[model samples]
Target chain A: MSASDHLIPVVVSNVVEVNPIIKRFEFKHVNGDELPAFSGGAHIVVEMLDDGTKRKNPYSLMSSPFERDQYAISVRRDDTGRGGSKFMHEQVRPGMQMKISAPVNLFALDLRARKHLMIAGGIGITPFIAQMAQADKLGVPFELHYAARSVSQAAYMDSLADRFGDHVSCYCDDQGESVDLETLLSNQPLGTHVYVCGPKGMIERVVQTATSLGWPAAHVHFEHFLAPPVGEPFEVHLAKAGIDITVGAEQSLLEAVEASGTPINCMCRGGACGQCETVVVACDGEIMHNDHWLDEEQRAAKQRIMPCVSRFRGKRLELDL
Target chain B: MTIQFKDESFRGDFTYANSPSNIPRFPFPFPEDEYMYSTNIEPHHAARAGSPFENAFDVDEHYVAEMKDRALVLADDPGRCQALPHMETAGWDFLELVMVSKARDYPDLFKLTMDGDRWHWINKPLQIDDTFTFGDSSTLPCHPMEYIGRQVQGDHAILDQRDGNLWMDAGIITAQADWSLDFDIGMNFFEWHAPVPLAHELGVFQRALKFLLTLPQGQPSRRLNWTLTVNPRLDTSPENYPKWGPDRMTVTPENIGEKVHLRVELQTFWRLPRSNAILFPIRTYLMAMNEVVTQPKWGRRLHRVMRDLRPELVDYKGLSRYHPILVEWLSQFDDGAPTSPGIFPD
Candidate 1:
């Protein structure tokens, strides 16, 4: 990768305060470069300064890439969060600067699927927004299920309704109009693809209902906003350092390394969060790992490790680095 | 708590020799562990003691039952692993990261998501009223502008043509997205229906990143972009088509099941001043087996020692030092007087 590969910078130009709690910042290329058009389920990695913490994070994009130099991202305030949200809410503003990765898509709309069933619980509505907008434009058949606590808490209530109207379904537990996911996803059409987002609960309902209803894993697509930590512990040996860092059963190899004072540069720590990646010359054992950076063969192949969340199947092994 | 290599940074007892049976060995000339990973052609030998999943995942009856009685043992009580607690993520991490980023970025950006890689919604289609939006009907209108809009939304980010500044700001802004922490408090898989297998899915992603980050920077002077040639072992199994991506031929897993070997080039770049770069060059070669890479004796020994040292899985897994040391000793290479590598600036 070029020094340029690791140095893609993002700038904020247009800012829209979506709500008292959420603010949307539109980022663009000051160099007048063509930004990658991303699918509805793609996100980019960014690096920023926080009051207490400094690291990069993986964030999904809400705006369509159709407009020039215009990409919108929404932020909510969380003083206790690991510094990013609080920073954006209180510190980040239009004209502020940051670094980001090229767009990567994992939740793309299936054009082959004749009909799209888009579901959003709370904030999950964003990714599907582009889909909804396009479906309307193409006069395609689609449905939007917007779920929130109530009207006040919903972020884009007016815009969703104004744009899609009757085709859109709004659900608020507080208002008692919540739709049952099982029924909605039940007896689905052959070419129907499901895009479910929002809170963990809504995602869960859609997935469970769809699965119980016999929807194939490929047909049901739900995006994970936060990557939960997983995997067994592995022994990591920095042969060069002559150390036997016993990466805790719970911690990732990357975390253990940093705790051991290895200043390995990392961007997104969540495996989906790709902040910590490192190379190894000689490794032995099946790499029981987590990461989007490698394909299936590479992952099972055991060539590299995301120390933050990867592990080894057997006992201790050595890393060439 | 641990033996940090950089400088006794953390508190730990075993700086070099921990257990009486194991001995540490470092390669000659290499600066640190970072150098080793970027420039080695070591094929990860398989273990004979069966799948190492038993010790890899911290499995429960419910967790195991969920995976058709086969679960890759995650960590050892991750909530309270003895060796390095800070090295791990917590429930708060999931809530803060997963929930917060989404909540903070709220209804904008593509609600930060995690699939094989980080992804979100591009949302807003080409145009709400463009009759030829997606099907084979390419004749919607006669305009050059719509094509331009499509170009912006589809491929520029990947080309490295767009400024990285925008991503930085947007990324930083949603740093503390903790909306998930607010509601549906606790529980592992699918809290309020979160996917259980996600833990495995996530592991697959982060591990891949670690491999990429540690790879030595690529050098164009020699036209040598680091690449990986995988040779997966799959003498068994029946299903097909396991992966996907734009490079579907490479990503879309083919009929070559289990022991499948494929070659891929890593798009890593680096052109260091001629005087300083290594003679071998920087590169990382990974070989994933999709549960087919069988382990030999060394693999079995590694897994065995890992489990035996378990309960305190931290030190247990670390015990694999014996595997390599034994291998070196058993093979033609010298083991007792293994040369050490330079720790810092050389």
Candidate 2:
């Protein structure tokens, strides 16, 4: 499963619907039968095999983290997406025993203070519902700010408002407007933490506000609905392997290594996890680490690399893979 | 996108979770942003907050930086107030814990206390007067009929007798530093959550795999505990979820001067219902990284990539968009884990 599952998956044994774009399945894993407790902003990754080759794609976990019984996730019919998401939406169906992974999360609610500021664009509201339910049960606190192109395309609104009361704030581009970043951020009491999930611009804007407020980068968090494009390239050395390969500007370090027949076990090719980690053999280049898998110390030391999506910092570098 | 409020004047260090001593005691990696923004620094200040709640999280970096070597703890962390902004979605009772030390990562933030079921920003705190008969029995949930008495802190606050839950909680950021009713800032109790994989038991994926348990009832699958961080790209990506709950989780017997090594494992499975009609039940695996070794590998890879992309491309925005949080997958190697592929493949 992708990192978002929180290492907990909602099991489904029945396929209620299937199409080239989405798959609706069901299962049981309650707290005696309880599925794991997943916060809002969580997701599940599915593994597929078109020809005995494994393929995995992460999808949004729409089920509320508050629900005890069965949970649900809605996946787009990503035909253009690799076999993982596209496969689930296209060919898989009901009564079939489908396996899912536990949820490993990067997105959870703020634990310290009372109050949650949820910003969801398009289908990003899925996980917020779960957090909302949990928030309700604890009476700790939270608010949902949902923004979408239109209400029709918006996943859930009325249910969220009804359950949450005046806490639900709506912003839709279709209405010729959307959330006012400055006003929203400015109006918030200092203790409140921010969470946003949606397109690139929306997430970035929120982060900017948080940063501008001098909120430590850690406080204002967001989950990108999609990955940004890759840029530049350079050489990486596999120290242990004593191999150095030149990554052309457009070429991924992974592609170059794989092309040379140096097998590196990699699962998520998008550089979201620490799967394709290659150690530094030696280097004389700038290091631009992009993976969350590394901590502050590693980033400071400058030895490893995620060849799949990472690029070189200097003219050359080294890896220990 | 983030909504900016006009008033930036926040007073009072967020007395998140704290212990009963004059030590900085909030856990590092404060949950989602249950942050502490205190510029208060004292050597041996200890004040007991008579209110309800327990724990600490989200220490303001500026505050943390100032209180380089101190201990802070909340004997009882008050529940998240409902009237706060964004109160609708963040519901649940929460207790925070934290500790600040002159030492680096391991010693900086330590000690913790918590329950199996977590508390959130919305839930009420436990009360000494509140009681229920629960002993690992299998029963569905429903509202209960139990009552608790109240405990007041001079004129500062009131708490439930059973569990020390407070009612009519006052504001922290909103309150003035001079607000007498708010928690006294001079105390240095340390509220904290011990890191899951306790410092002593760091292991690779292969060895870490032993601590896994399958679903006792549902289709046989497992789950694992993991931490998240932004990497590969500095951007943690659009997929990274926020940790909205308590930032600090305590290791057992934290105050008794004991430590337990943790082993987070990997659990793999598919999400499908057994009763529904389906042809193929897809199987997938999830895992927690063997953090000790894997983190280094990630650092190595990322350094090279950054060197390749150059600084202009290394802006926080590009990096934040790509950072991957704690992701788990089936381990593919013996000494180490196979590299993770891009979850959001283009």
Q: Tell me each candidate's i-RMS in Å.
A: 17.2, 12.4
lDDT of 2 by residue, B1-346 (tens): 1111122111133222212221122111112111122211111112233211111111222223112111111112222111223221111111111111111112323222223432111111211222223211122122110010011011111111001111222211111111222332221111111221222233432222211111111122322222232111111112212321112132122211111111111212211121010011111111112322133333233323323433332332223222221111111222333334421101
Q: Every model's DockQ, to 2 decimals?
A: 0.03, 0.02
| Model 2 CA deviation exceeding 4 Å by range | A1-33, A66-68, A214-218, A226-276, A282-303, A307-319, B1-346
Query: How well is each residue in A279-298 modelled by candidate 2, as lDDT tens digits?
Result: 77677766777565577788
**Which 10 consecutive positions of candidate 2 chain B have the poorest summed lDDT?**
B145-154
Candidate number with greatest lDDT = 1
Q: Against the native chain B, what TM-score does each candidate's chain B reach?
A: 0.17, 0.17
Relative to the true structure, how large is the alpha-carbon lDDT of every model? 0.42, 0.40
lDDT of 1 by residue, B179-204 (tens): 12112222212232232223344463
Candidate 1 lDDT tens digits, A56-129:
55566777633435667666555544456666667677787777665554455654457888888776677777
